[model samples]
Target: MPDDRVEVEEEPVSETRLSLTADCGSCFGLCCVALPFTASADFAINKEAGKPCRNLREDFGCGIHTQLRQKGFNGCTVYDCFGAGQHLSQGTFGGTDWRREPKSAQQMFEVFPVMRQLHELLWYLNEALTLAPAKPVHADLRELLARTEALTGGSAEELARLDVPGHRQQVNLLLLRTSELVRAQVPGKKRNRRGADLIGAKLRKAELRGADLRGAYLIAADLTGADLRDADLIGADLRDAQLAGADLTGAFFLTQPQVNAAKGDPSTRLPGRLTRPAHW
Candidate 1:
């Protein structure tokens, strides 16, 4: 099937952290073929699990690269390969491009997603370690950060054989420790308010799974990877909220408009179709 996934413009290089700016030009589009997507609100059309997008050229660049969104493939716009795609295509695999060696294509593609996932965890874990107040856990943080970085540099064959979920669990443990170190200082007492004003709060990774957030002002909140499953978002204003990697799978009373008004990253899994929240 034609790669109908929407593509967003390349973000400003400076917008990404220095740690993430590893060379990716050497990669041969392994991510495009390795990851799978089906037609839904996020994707424009249905595609088989392993089939390459029709727009992918023999050179491994998108044929509609510059016009992805215009061509009705917005999903591509929000994707960030985290340098994993290219790293495996060129560095780990010694620039053995997938096209020439058709047999290696599947393995190369498979490793891309796995490496990308590991890179994503490293990104968040690194971010957590940077918080000033989490200084108490500095020693542990440094150890974990080094471990995560080492994992990123693992060989393609090693990465392809990695257990991503298990790695994620280890990283999650550190993140939880980081969160506790920070939140422990802040009073957990809930303030009295009928409809509290929480607009644009930095609630990233907060455990709000079953919290009563009804009719609350949540505009532009950074909800990256927050556990919102089964939470009450009824009448909650989600305009400009960042739902990157957030889980709203079973969130209650989350109307389409509420989701439509917010900004969502590709990792943001919502209950239903609605283009990523508009205020990206």
Candidate 2:
């Protein structure tokens, strides 16, 4: 029941100025090449790790970029790299591309996944620092943020050798504390459903304000018109969940990929930072 949702998807939400936002143009298609996918509901074909996706273009763009979902690549539409691609391409590897520098390809692929985890942590820590309810840990969060940010700047070899999970555990500790502080401010008793198996459960118009749904499986749940203000949704699987008319204002740690996987309409209120998914 742990928050494995963090590792399930990597793409950062678009339409945000957040440092973790994925700008594919600034990247070298690391996700397309460094990560593998299997033919499933999310992907259209089975690809081996470290192999470039056939849809990848010569300039590191997806040839089917505009039609990913249409082409059975639903995963590509929601998968985010948390800006790790650009950070590695332009900063860590100094614009050295895998295709151009065949020798560095394997090394770059190895370092990408590691760098991605670091950047994901950065995104969460940055979010924690912004919550006034979590102000008690602001100073500590800033320190952790600085440390994680510094890790992202390490050399490719250093990044490849990084103990990412160990570092993630260290970061998770403070994040847990931050979540407690923020949720404590809720008026009524907050529901503790961390990592609950609520897949396809009927939760229509549920009062889940300030709920702790971290890593919860909400797949296909009917959450229409639910009040989810100030909820912690880090790593929550929301695929095909009914969010029509749901209000998620002030929800923390909810990423774009989660939103993309859910079904919503114009009436579905989202946090200020997240835009309505194109498919919705």
Candidate 3:
């Protein structure tokens, strides 16, 4: 049976201020309108892309803000806007509420997602640069960070017209470099099992903490009851990875959406922000 009594801690809003990152509260609820969600694995309802969610209030706040999960909208709880939604909705657009400015609403909505992507990249790029082992790529990191930040600060029109995929490609290059630097410091023969076909591997109760299993094809691996504390699961393809009773506490760089996209049973352990996999 699942321990329903185990309380999940909410992410402290104050953690956003510790870094020079995007501030979601400063902007209006742009993501609610700009991004579309479908009744897929992540969302419980079929929402058209670019349509405002039914829970979004006229003032641009979430109607289900406090009771998101209880209302079957748990996906909203794990999403972090990196402050770009508010920045574009309020700062760059001069506090013009999208509802009141009907003509500009479409443009505002379009630009919101673009800025969100840029800000998300900034978040990951900033995190990559913080690794001590990535010192050799410090100069490149600095340059990329500056460029990404500047792109986020562009006008709504400019942001809407921006080639976000190109920028993402550039950041991916830096991430590749950072990965190499970190893994080179690992004092062991590089695991040939990387990106290996590990579907249905009996890794139950295994201790894989702090392991470099990047980009490993771990589809359908029976990781039940495994200890993955502080694991570097970046780029690990965990589609269908059996996480029943597995402990993923403190797994670094593990995104909520990515975890939500996987399959897990009720006994699965997850980071605080995510609920048990809905498909479990």
Q: Pick by lDDT: which candidate is best?
A: 2
TM-score of 2: 0.93
Model 2 ranges off by over 4 Å: 1-18
Ordered from best to worst TM-score, the candidate numbers read 2, 3, 1
Q: Name model 3 segments beyond 4 Å from true.
A: 1-24, 189-202, 207-232, 235-252, 256-280
Question: What TM-score does each of the candidates earn?
Answer: 0.61, 0.93, 0.72
Model 2 weakest 10-residue run by lDDT: 1-10
Question: What TM-score, to 2 decimals, does candidate 3 have?
Answer: 0.72
In order of listing, the candidates' clash counts read 11, 5, 5
- The weakest ten consecutive residues by lDDT in model 3 span 1-10
Residues 157-229, candidate 2: write the lDDT tens digits. 8898889989999999999998888878777889999999999999999999889999999999999999998
State which candidate has the highest TM-score: 2
Candidate 3 on 115-223: residue-level lDDT in tens?
A: 7777677666666655567778878877888888788778878887899889888988887677666545544444434466677788888877545566677877888
Residue 67 Cα positional deviation in candidate 2, in Å, after optimal superposition: 1.0
- Scanning candidate 1 in windows of ten residues, the lowest lDDT window is 3-12
lDDT of 2 at 212: 98
